[model samples]
Every structure is written in structure tokens, then in C-alpha cells.
Target: MPTTASMTRRLAIALTSVVAIFWFVALGLGVYVMQDEFTEIFDSGVQETAERLLIIVANNEARDASGRPVEAAVLAPALNSQYLTYQVRDSNGMVLYADGAQEPFAVPLSAGFSQTATHRIYTAATTDGTLFVQVADALDHRSEALMEGGTALLLPLLLLIPGSIAAIIFVVRGTLSPVAQLRDEIHTKDGGNLAPIDESALPKELRAIARSVNSLLARLKSALEAEREFTSNSAHELRTPIAGALAQTQRLLSEVPPAFHQRTAQIERALLHLGRLAEKLLQMSRAEAGIGISDERADLLPVLMVVVQDLERSPLGASRLNVKVEDGTALERSVRADAFAIVLRNLIENALIHSPPQSPVDVHIDINGIRVTNDSALIEPDVLVNLTKRFTRGPTEASGSGLGLAIVKRLVEQMHGQLLIASPARGMTQGFEVEIRL
Candidate 1:
């Protein structure tokens, strides 16, 4: 499963992209509107300057030295300049006055504003015959102004994108904090701790989740309690009858002759297997109840040595178990004694039953975990897959009730540990190995 940050990061990126796209579109529309308005203003400014020049020409009534009208240069600011350029021609197509840039404009004695290829031209007529006053401004000036205005409009949004991304990350993380809290709370929970969550301080969206989790915890707690009670009671009742039956069978065997000893031994084996099965059931019940899930730690090396000793004293156990430890006291600091005992006992017992006759079982303990190796024929892969299942027995002369591996697996899970079964141990290809990590 992906973390909340990864999931929300994609959402934030999508949101940021939406906002950025909107900014791009809005900026484009704004630039278009601004450019349109600027064109109107520029054209109006040119027209106003031309009208002013016309009024000046009309008011001054051109003359030379005497009271006679004649062609003359216009005012100081009106000739050959970048801002306002003008040309006036008479009805006869002769230049009466020209006060603008050095290049002359082609005119046909027309009137009003007209545009040429390179300039915006405004021509006007006086009261006299089709006389013209032409004012021109270049097209490149308008394009440059539009570009500058568009850049000004886009610059702010371009700069704001980085800040927007940062804000999005901050907001997304803050919004998902409650989810992180919920996950941490659930992660620490186990079978032993089924307490209800306090949803009062949580946000409304997460309160429902907290309540649902609390409901599940309450159900699990009840189920575990009921299961433990049933298993404990049933095991106790069966063990009493089973022990009495075994005693009776032993007494009957003594009374019978040597010819019936084989039949009595078969009966004794069945009773013993049943007793072992009942004991394993009780251990499984305690494991499910999390009876010893506490801080009390057990050093696995010494525990392994004790298990070896106990197995040697038992009839169904291997004759000898060779124990080896990397460090003796170095592994003393550990926890979950009950779980370690359950898994170790079952693994060692199972190994003893399957190991070749007179071959010593190997028990190796390290700082991390323990590995129990026994010399035995390899089990098939398909069959090995089901070895941990309940009532699954291996094909061997010395048989078992088949709940050993299953019980070990359950107890190991309760202790927050791992149980791994391997055939042929690591190097060789003829033995079996059971490894447990705490």
C-alpha cells in the first residue's frame, strides 16, 4: 500500500495543474483585452494630435513676411519626430507644408483615417479643395506595446506558481494528519490490546472510521475470550479421562500375556497421542488469549538448552540433541518466553520423531533467533506447503497427532515473530530445519 503522502501528492499536482491552466487562460484573455484597449488609445492619441495640428494650421493662416498666405514650416515639436509626423498637400497635388519624418507619404488627396502596409495614417480635409493633413504612426510600435503589456500581465502568475505549489504541499499534509494518526493507532494494536478508540478529538470524516475500528476490536476481544474458555475447559475434561484410560491400559497390559503386548502397545500409543493433542490445544488457546504478551523477556539460548535437556528425558523425544550457541549470555535479553517455549517444544518434538535412528538433532541459537536441524529424508514441495495445516502428518514410521507445527505457527504469530520451515537445512539436501525469529 502506498503512503498517504504519495496518494495526496498526485491530487495536489492535479489541483495545481488546474489552477495553472486557469491562470494561463485568464492571462491570455486579459492580455487580449488590454491590447485591444491600448490600440484604441494609441489610435485616439494619433487622431487628437492630427486634429491639434489642423487647428494650428487653420488659426495661424500661413504667411511669409507680408499679409499674404504662403507655404511655411510648422511648429518646433511637429517636424520629423517619432511621435507625431504630418504632411499637408494642396488641391493641385503640390506639397504646401510638410513637417514630419524625412520620408514622404503617398497621398491621393483623400480624407479621414486610412491604413497603409507599415503605418496607421489619418488624413483630414480643410474648408478648401480636397487639401489633406496626413498623420502616420508605424505598426511595429503598436506590436511592441502589445508585447510589453502581455509580458507584464503574465509575469505575476509565472512567479506565483512556485509559491502555489508550496502552499498545496503544506495544505495536503495538514489535511491528512488525522489519517496518519489513525494509522499509527491501528498499527500498534494487537490481540492483547482491544481497547476502543477515542473519536471525540478526531475530525468528522475520521470519527466514523475510529468507531468502526472500536466495534471490530470489541468483537475480537469477545471472540478471543470465548475461544479460550472453550479450549481450556475441553482440554481439562479430556485430559482427565485420557490419563485414566492410559493408566487402565497399562494395568491391562501387565495382566495380559506377552502375546497381547503388541495390541496393548498400540492402544497405549493412541492414548498418548490423544493426550499430546489435548495439551497442544490448551497451548493454542493460551496463545490466542495473548496470556503472556508482556515485557518479560527470555534469553532464547538458555531456553533452547533447557528444551534439549527435557527432550532427552522424554520417551517420544530424540535420544540426544546437540546444542550450540554463538554467544551464551549475549542472548539473555529477549521477550515472549511463553511463545518461544511453545514453538521450540513443538519444533524439537517434531524433529525428534522424524530424525533417523540414533542421529543427534542439532539446535543452534544466536543473538537473533534459533534454528533446529534434524537429519531426515526430504519432503515434497507440494506436501510441505500443507505441513503447517491442522491435522497434517508427515509420512514417517514414528508418527504424530499433526497439530505440532500448526500450534507453533499460531503461537509465533501471537509473539510477533516468524516461523520458517525449510527442507534440507541450508547447505545439505537430506535434512529438515525449523527456524524461529523473535
Candidate 2:
């Protein structure tokens, strides 16, 4: 029952969250890879500076002891901006010279040339008897650089979050506009309206949805028509029994006849009316349900003949009735028809009730279709449209329940056939027409 907009918005949010997680993971990996390069560059710069300094000291003129051998003041300035520590130590551990004003710096020695697991330590022995070691605190330096770069990228994305959300809201609303219109249209629609949704403004992706909705609406329209007809039929069929009971009651009330006589007469008349109504309704129900109809192919003309003849023997069919089958018509050729007999019966019965007494009813059958036309004035054109609806009746005439024509329509449609009604307008030439495919 959730609206389309809500569903779309949720999906957008979920996708955004996934993208954010992926971005974070990628950022972490990028920083890790770049960290190694930063360390390598820093180490190479320090080593080159150390090697240059060693060459300078080994090439310095070896003046007499009184001349101050390579004064520490001269060397101190050269090592000022570099990450190196140097010391000249004798074989007996006596410090001959050093860079800073302290004892020889304690340089942790490893077994051989190996990169210490620690962030910053590199050592090498110079030919001039000087120990050159480079020391740098790269862990803290790298942490600061990563923080700065991450902030720059993260700040922009954080700002974009609101825009992304707003975009999702806008897109969701725009994408669902047709559905909203459909909702409002349906909201105002009443039982009398069953028109389909218009899809001219819909996007291609949403066209399928609109088509589905239209199909559902079409089905609802048919169902509503059937329901209205059913109600009309019930009311029409109930009238006779109600009128009979009222008449019997009036007679008993006017004259104080014997108790048994009045009571028995009223009960019998009521029971008769009820029985007839029930029988007709049952027949209509069975026919509409397509019960007992076989799938075997049968000639439509022969079926119509049998039903018309049977109706002629009944009281309703005593009027002038005729059956005509087009000889050698292509419609007589065997077709796929399982409910031929029921179809014929319903059409004939409907024509008999509608036509006036002594008026001829024409039953025509051909290869393509069968049509029943009565001599009576046709029901109005609009009324014909709803004739197939359950419980519907003609505007002026009300005899049997209106379910008969409805049953015929349902049966015909179920067989993938069609039903059509046509008659002349506003003249004595008007007559009921019913057509059904084989």
C-alpha cells in the first residue's frame, strides 16, 4: 500500500549510503598506498644529504692540530636543516668530535642493513671514520598530511549530501506525478465512472504501470455493470410475488372469509410466484456460470433451431415466432464452440420475452455469427449498451428478471466471442438485435 514516491525515495537513500561507504573504503586504501611513497622520498633525501657531508669532511685540508681540525662551528650550520646526526669517535669509545653539544648520540644498531620496523631510522658508516645516521618522525608527519587531505575531500561531500537529498525528493515527486494524478482522479470518481487512466504524459518506464492500471479499470467497469444488472434483475423478478401477495392480502382484509380459505389461497399464490422467480434465476445463474456446456464443435444453426423450437412450445413463446438459418453459409462450417446450445437458448428466450404477442421473432444464423431480431420496438440505444449487465431491464417494460441478457453476454464473452445490439431510431421500424459469434 505504500505510495510510489516513498518507495523511490527509500531506494535513493539506500544507494547514497552504499556510495558513501565505498568512497570511505577507497579513501583509506589510497592514503595507505601514498604513505609508503612519502616515506621513501623522505629517506632518500636524508641519505643523499648525509653522503655529501661525508665527502666534504673527507676532502677538507688536514691542517696542524693547532689550526682547529674542521671547526665544529663550520659543520654545525651545514647540518642545521638536515635530518642527520654525525659523531667522530675513537676506537676506545672517546668522542673526538660531534655535531651537537653532547656525548655521541646513542644510535640503536641492528644486526645488518635492514629497514627497522619503526617509522624513522637509517644508519651508514662513512670512510672518514664518521657515523652518519638519519632520524625522522614520519609517523606523525604522515598522519597530519592524511588528515588535511581527507578533510578537503570530505568537506565537499558533506556539503553535497543536502543537495543529493533535495534532488532525490524532486526526482521522486516528478517521477510519480502521473500516479498522483491517477490517485486524485480515482478519488473523485464515483460508481458511474469507470474510465481508464490517461497515459499520454507518462514516461516510457511508467507506461507499463499505466497500462496495468487501465486494464484493472476496464475489469472493474465490467464487474460494476454486472453488479448493477444483478440488482435490477432481482428487483424486477421480485415484483410479481410482492404484487400477488399484496392482492391476496387485500382480498382477505376486505372480506372476512373462512380462516382456512383465505390463508390457503394466499399461501399458494405466494408460493407459486416464489417458485417461478427461483426457477428463472437458477436458469440464468447456471447459464452464466457456463455449466454443463461441452467444448465439442457443433453447428450453430442446428443449436438455434433446437432452442427456438423448444421455446415455441412454452407459454412465453406462443406468440408468432420464426427461425431462419442461412443455407450453406460459411458460419455453418464447424468452429470451436463448446456452449452452442446454451448460447442459442438464452438468445431465443430473451427475444421471445421482449417481443409483443403475435409478433414474429427472427433467428438468423451464419458461419460468422448468429443474430436474434424481434419485431417489437427496440430498447433505447443507451439501454442496449447496458443490456448485458446483470439485473437490468428496459425503461418501460418489466416482465422477467433482467439477468437473461446479462447471462448471454457473459457466456458470449467467455467464449472469446462478441455481443452487439442494433435497431432503427425513433420510428416504428425499431426492433431488438442481438449478435453472438460462434
Candidate 3:
């Protein structure tokens, strides 16, 4: 099965990703700006050092014993490490003096600033242009500075990414909690539960949805109630007249001559069939009215036994039915006694009526559920699947209103139980079975 994506998860991920992307972009921009500023400051320092060394070397050049100028060198040693290294070169690009530099810089003697593969060099000249002072700063030093600065900015982000993700997920889930609640409320609505959703706790964005759902539920409830009422009233009104007509036809059969007896008997059988149909309609109406659920729990074993006994009183049911209740089992449930009775009657009656003559109908009750099986040829899969529909029957000539399984299925669903129908009943080669799980 394909999995559904959750709104909360999607929202959280989208928000977190956007936040992370923006943070990284901003960090990159910040590092770029910082590197530029650092370069400017280091270049100014190199230029200033070169200009000062030019003036100092011109005024304080070392003199030989004959009072002629010679090479001059200025060296400053500090306790801490030095960041700038420099060497002074004359106009011919000859090394005149050195400080912390190991060798002459790889550049022509020129004024202003220049760069090599390893260093940033600023060359300054005298008024006479006879000498030049070139100061060098190592490229690795600036790179180290930029790396440290970038690390400082990135460390906080490492901690922030996880925290932001958690915070985003938390907020998204909290914001969507009302939607989850609304979904649960809508899911609970069915034939048995059509109650309106509570809108007081919903956010403004979802309040309209709740109100619309409530309106729809109200309409459905009213329609179902009206339908049930009509069915119940019609069935109730027809019962007496049907019974009276049946009784009168039987009387006429006895009083009429032998030639007319067949017609009267046909009329009586028709009335009986009509009466049974009316009764089934009544049961269907009751089932639709959600009569299966109850707050009070009861021991349903006795109810099952009563229905079986009642069915067995008929000649057709005599010695053809068998029931087995597992040892240490209790049929305690929250279903109403009358509703359970109706379900049992319909199931057992369906089995008895549809199975082959003299074939045993078996009823088994266990801790898990109830099973009713009857010996018969395997019903087609297509027909079996629809056997629970109203007026749909298997390929049998047995007389049935076809509402028995339909009624059973409705009540079972209202009771929040499962009803499964199978051909070639469990452990049998050719039979039909209905199992109810509550």
C-alpha cells in the first residue's frame, strides 16, 4: 500500500530546510565580507610599515669608518610571534635590509601594493627614488584568520540546526493538532454515530469546516431517522392485517371443497411469505436505528441458547442442528439482548434454510467469536461476496427473504463487530460459513 504523507511532517521539513538554507547563505556572505575587510586592514598595515621603513632607512643609514653610506638593517624582536615579515629593497630590486624575512621578496621594486603567490607586498620609495622599502605579509596568515572567523560563525549553526528542527516540528505538530482532532471526529461518524463535531476548540481556519460537517451530519441523521420510522411504521401496520388474512385463508382452505383447496392454500402460503417479509423489514429497520450498541453488559450465552431452542421447535430444525460452546467461555458483551437475538436468528435460519436436506447445521462459540456453518456445495466467490446484500441470495431454490444476512451484517457493524462470509467452510471441502468477531 502506498503511504500517505503527513501535513505536519511536510510543513516541518519545508520550514526547516528553508531556515537552514538561509542561514548557510547568510553565513557565506558574512564570511566573504569579513575576508574582504581583513584583507584591507592587513594591506594598510603593510603599506604603513613600508612607508615608515623608507623614512627611517634614509635618515639612519649605517656609515662605514670613512663616513660613506653602507647597508642598513632594522630588526625588532618580540616575546610573542610576529604576523608580518618584511624586507627592504633598493630601486634595482636589490635587498638592502631584512627583518623576519628569510629571503628577498619575489617582486620588482615599485611603489604602491602588489601580491605574489606567498605574500602581500607594499613597496614605498624615497623622494630621490634611490631606494625602496618593500614590506611583506604572509598569505597563510590572512587565510588562518579567515578560517578562525568562519569557524566561530559555523559552530553556533551546528547547534542551532538541530534545535531549530526540533522547534519547527514541535510548533507544526501543535498547530495541526486541531486538524487531527477534527479528523478523528469525522472518522467516528457512521450509521451508529452521527453526532455533530465540536467546533469550540477549533481554530478560526477550521471552524467553517467543522460547521459544514456538522450540517451534513445533521441532515444524514434526520434522513436515516425518517427512513427507519417509515419502515417500522409500515411493518407494524401490515403485521395485523397480514396475520388476519393468513388466518382467514387457512379457515377458507378447511371450509372450501377439495377442488378449491389448492387455490386457498396458495393464498395462505402467499400471506405467510408476505408476513415473513414484513417481519424482516421490521428487523432491518431496528438494525438501522442503531439498536445493537448498549452501555450495559450482559451474558449473551443464554440469549443464544434461547434462539437456538426456538428454532429447534420447528420440524425442519429438529435433530438437524448442532451447537458447541467452548469450555470456560463466556458470551458477555455490550450488545443488547434483542439485537443479539435477531442476529443469531437470522444467521441460524439462513444456515438451516439454505443447506441441503438432512445436512447438519453447526454453531460453534469460542472465546474469539461465533461461527455458523452449514453443509452445502461451494458457493461461487462472486455470489458469496454479495450474499449479504438485501434481496441477494446464493444459487439455491430455498425460499428466503434475502434480508437475513443483510440484517446480521448491519447489526454486527453497529456493534463494532466483523462479519466474514466464506464458501467451502473452514476445514470442510464443501460448505458455507459465517463468522462474527466482536
Q: Highest TM-score: which candidate? A: 3
Q: The CA-based lDDT of model 3 is what?
A: 0.85
Task: In model 2, state the lDDT of residue 186.
Answer: 61
Clashing residue pairs in candidate 3 (N, C-alpha, C atoms within 3 angstroms) = none
Model 3 lDDT tens row, 1-438: 999888877877888789888989989999999999999998988888778777777666544445886544333431112777667676677776677665778777778888999888898988777778878888999999999999998898889878887898899888888999999999877765676888999999999999999999899889877877887688778998998999899989999999998888889988989999889989988897887876568899999999999989997798888999999999888778888999999999889989988789999999877999999888989888899999898888888888999999999998889999999998999899999998
User: Any runs in candidate 3 off by more than 4 Å, and if so which?
Assistant: 1-4, 59-87, 92-111, 115-119, 138-144, 155-159, 174-182, 194-223, 281-299, 313-328, 334-338, 356-360, 375-386, 389-392, 422-432
TM-score of 1: 0.76
lDDT (CA) for every model shown? 0.77, 0.61, 0.85
lDDT of 1 by residue, 1-438 (tens): 975648568867888899889988988998889878987897887777777777666655644435876444445465436655777666676665676554557645576677778888887677775456778888888888888988887888877787778888899889988888898888866765566787987899999999999999899889877876887788789899999999999999999999999999999999998798779878866776775354445556666667778888887564578877775435543346555677788898888878877778888887667888988889877877889898897767876777889888887776677888888688887788888876
Q: How much lDDT does candidate 2 score? A: 0.61
Clashing pairs in 2: 229-390, 229-391, 230-390, 230-391, 233-391, 330-367, 331-366, 331-367
RMSD of 1: 4.7
Clashes of each: 3, 8, 0
TM-score (C-alpha, index-matched) for candidate 3? 0.77
Which should have the higher TM-score, number 1 or number 3? Answer: 3
Runs with alpha carbons beyond 4 Å of true place in candidate 1: 1-7, 55-61, 64-86, 91-119, 127-130, 192-212, 256-264, 277-309, 324-336, 377-395, 413-416, 420-430
Tens digit of per-residue lDDT, candidate 2, span 1-438 = 975656667967976677677777777776676677776676676566555555554445354334755654565576643334455444344555565434643444321123334345344445554344333333555567767777766776686667777777788877778777767866643333456767787678777877887788788768756864675476567766666776776666566657667676766566665655665575566454433223244555555566677788888787557666677775443332434665677777777767776677777677678777876665677877887787788764636667777767766655556787776522347877777765
Estimate TM-scores for all models: 0.76, 0.50, 0.77
